[model samples]
Target: MESYIQISKINDFIFCPRSVYLHTIYDNFHKKSYQRTPQIAGTIAHESIDTGAYSSRKRYLMGKEVYSDELSLCGKIDIYDLQTKTLIERKRKVVKIYDGYKYQLYAQMACMREMGFEIETLKIHSLSDNKSYILDMPNEEEWQKFIDIVERVNNFSVAEAKILADSKKCAQCIYQPLCHPL
Candidate 1:
């Protein structure tokens, strides 16, 4: 059977490899309904952006669903600037660029490229800071690293992928109870 991967899974693996294992291998886990203020805010922001409720003067595409058969990956891009050939991702916070975010963007970019879009730049619009970061696309080395991570996760057995229950992240994790039973 042909296996496919979601862009979110790439982020999850980067956040915690255990999350990928638990989410993919186990069917018992339940998603939490209660979202924190920040998460809620981000969701709202993304919805507005996705619905084209937030307008810009530039010619662009919003909320495009793209998939790459070559990479067997799929994701929706927040925005694609037609005139500038740039991709924009929105986030509620802008502390720093994480590997997960980078990989997510890379997957989106790869999908776009496979679809024959000319993507020249990558940008992240940080709602908290009201700042826009013009990011360089992942270089060859970073792309290789992402590919390696994907391959590792694809081959990971349930037992080999242990739960990494970090104190701070656990509080936000939906599968926390499963990982750390009281």
Candidate 2:
């Protein structure tokens, strides 16, 4: 039997399959060089939400985990407004705004949907630019797209393939030496 998959990994794979393939299949991961600005911004944003001290007039919770026997997904939701019953997913980045973040957020919303919670909205925040985008959760048709992506990830896990030789992405991975012999 295959091991269970994390919804976050699905998001990671979507961001860049090469990264995911290295992280999961080869057990390779890039080391964090230092405490970066993006990481700091995310931490502060989450702390503010969890405390409910922010002047924003929204009843929300931070860092929620939605799980199921068939699938388990967990992440820090920046804000969940009780009035609107929305789950806010946030990302703080200096450069690229990858779609992987959206995929990851959507998976979390799907998990919440499975739990019978009505998610009114899914929000993404770009800290650098101070802009927000709302992902409409009321739309059922959108879920089909996510389902297809998830299935593709599942299929990738079963296929037997060796790691590519001497790739830069491999060098940064923890399992580099094992997967690719230099």
Q: Once superposed on the true structure, which residue ranges of model 2 sit more than 4 Å away at CA?
A: 1-3, 25-58, 70-76, 94-98, 138-141, 158-182
Candidate-wise lDDT, in order? 0.78, 0.60
* TM-score of candidate 1 against the unseen true structure: 0.83
- Candidate 2 structure quality by residue, lDDT tens digits, 90-177: 6665344456666777777767777777877777777768788876553466567777777777667524344555467555444444
The local lDDT score (0 to 100) that residue 128 gets in candidate 2 is 68
Please report the candidate that would top lDDT against the real structure. 1
What would the per-residue lDDT of candidate 1 be over residues 1-182, giving only the tens digit for each residue?
67768777888787777777666655443333434456567778898777877776569788888988888888799899999999988888889988888778888998999999999998888988799988877788988998887777667666767756467887766555556652
Candidate 1, lDDT over the whole model:
0.78
Q: After superposition, how far is residue 99 of candidate 2 from its true place, in Å?
A: 3.3
